[model samples]
Target: MTAWTMSDTGRSAAGGLPAGETAAQLVHRRLRDDIVSMRRRPGDVIFEKEIALEARVSRTPVREALLRLADEKLIEIVPKSGTMVARIPAEILPEIIVARAALEAVTVRAAAESARGSDIAGLRAIIERQRETLATGDIDGFHATDEVMHRAIAEAGRLPGLWSMIVQIKVQLDRYRRLTLPQPHRMERALAEHEAIIDAIAGRDAETAAAAMDRHLDGLRVSLAPIRDLNPDYFSGDVGAVYDRWAGEMA
Candidate 1:
């Protein structure tokens, strides 16, 4: 696991905030991105002293940022044990996916009915950029573009606020998606699904577009199984039982 630090270039890759961004905001964005991208894996301790040193700021700002992240449930601050990245709770995943699918399905259907030719072209351009990112094996870049593409659909539907809601709901799902990104051909398959959804929307077929979105989200549910199997420690919920069984077997 590579340690993520603020760049010497004075610009961090938390999607490149404006010049006036505060140190606390910068710290929050960098750490949040690292957590979501799995660069800071679940259960990994987050030391305020180290982060403050790396960011060239005092521990006060770092502590403030960590408190914000804790509110988002991205990191847990134990009373005496310190802070660690929060594990994905296995039980809530289905609920998150279901909520996303419902909202996104409604969004895509609206996009199909209301999107202009320019909107369709813009989406196609995003897909092309995703291809370029895939060719270069930039998973992080691909993920960024993936987010842009979905947000574009919401904007096309004239429901830009829905994108914000989706963003909040998908935080956990984003972590799980990052976990699955290294699997063979996952990005390629996701691109194909995106193309299908775009085609349906471009054709002005609301039913098809909604169904395509649902199917795409369904694939996310399927992807979780293998990731859980590979990284049993990165998830919560049944982990205690699993550990207990392992201990019994060893005994």
Candidate 2:
């Protein structure tokens, strides 16, 4: 398990915050990012006091932030055992892939119809940066760019609100994606898929763009088995049962 620590600089990982952002909101954002990025790994315990000390805030805010994370299913707060980052359960991957594929396919189709030349240029610029990150072996940078690329598609499609909803649901999927980042040829394959999607959109072929998005998302499903094999302890074999037990205990 990885240890959690606050930066001495006191800046949020999500960058500059708007005015009047509460301590709980800052803590929640930082912790959520850390958990998704695997800086705080599955099953790692989180102490409110330690987090409070690091964030230079009261335990009240830490507790409030944790409850918010719990609502997102990003972390589990056990009655006696305290809080821990939630494991990336294998059972939910298929569902998440399906949902994301449906939403993103629609998004790309819309983008093919609505995206301006500048939007396409911006996406290509991001891909270029992604290529640079791959060459430099900056896995984190590549992943960050990957997210921006997808969000750019949503923005181009005039679905920024839908993108927010996708962000909420893709937290676990993001973790799974992170797990596959270091795999052999994975980044290259993803880059190729992204290019295909971009090409279809640039050509204003809505059908092709949707097809490409579906194919790209389906690739995520293909990687799940290999990921489970690689990190057996990181997923629940019986996810429903586990969730039921957690809900019962919480109730």
Candidate 3:
């Protein structure tokens, strides 16, 4: 188990946030959101003092948050090099996404077969919340609800290990998911996908549920297709070029 160094309560001392906000919490939220939302691009170095100044908080919380981010494999802490954002091997990401599709297919199938009336109700509630979030155009709320919806399916399957593994893998591709959402109709498409999967699971149609989940994962490739063409310079290293070469070879 990776030790989370920041104690639940000890995380608050570094910055002077409002009366209700602790420095640690503020730092953690800011850094985590920045990384997930791709605002802190991969390979960006985060200086505690700079973040503290920007956040209007103290260095303590920022340090604690950095520690936590390191644990999550979202950042690297080097004694002499400072803290750098994590840069996953972009070329291998496609393979990882394929693995994710396989795992989710199994998980959703199991969930569909095992889900009870109560479980179906729970999933419905999450869908309702997602609809509300969409109606309000609350990206954060929709993101949070998306998590709840996915977890609910895993829980219904009674597979904690599978759920944990999927989460770990999904986090690796989260940068893509975050970026995909900003594209036109991405949110609407995602909502439709979610509805299809949830409906299948609710109906206890294991095959249908698994197929829906697979389709959802496959959509990722479609989303990434245009990105590679429009922003070739933005992606670093040979990763982007390599992918382009792979496509040419396949063709």
TM-score of 3: 0.75
Sliding window of 10 residues with minimal summed lDDT for model 3? 1-10
TM-score against truth, every candidate: 0.88, 0.87, 0.75
**Residues 130-244, candidate 1, lDDT per residue (tens digit)?**
9999999999999999999999999889889888999999998899999887899999989999999999999999999999888888877767667788999899888455444
lDDT tens readout by residue for model 2, 1-251: 23334453255776444357788887897898898998888888898999887777789989999999998888999998889988887667666776788888878999999999999999899999999999998999999999999999999999887788888778898998899989999999989999999999999999999998887887776676677678777786674554454335434
Best candidate, TM-score: 1
Q: Which wins on TM-score, candidate 1 or candidate 3?
A: 1
Best model number under lDDT? 1
What TM-score would candidate 1 get against the native? 0.88
Q: Which regions in candidate 1 have their CA more than 4 angstroms from the true location?
A: 1-20, 239-251
Q: Candidate 2: misplaced stretches above 4 Å? A: 1-18, 239-251
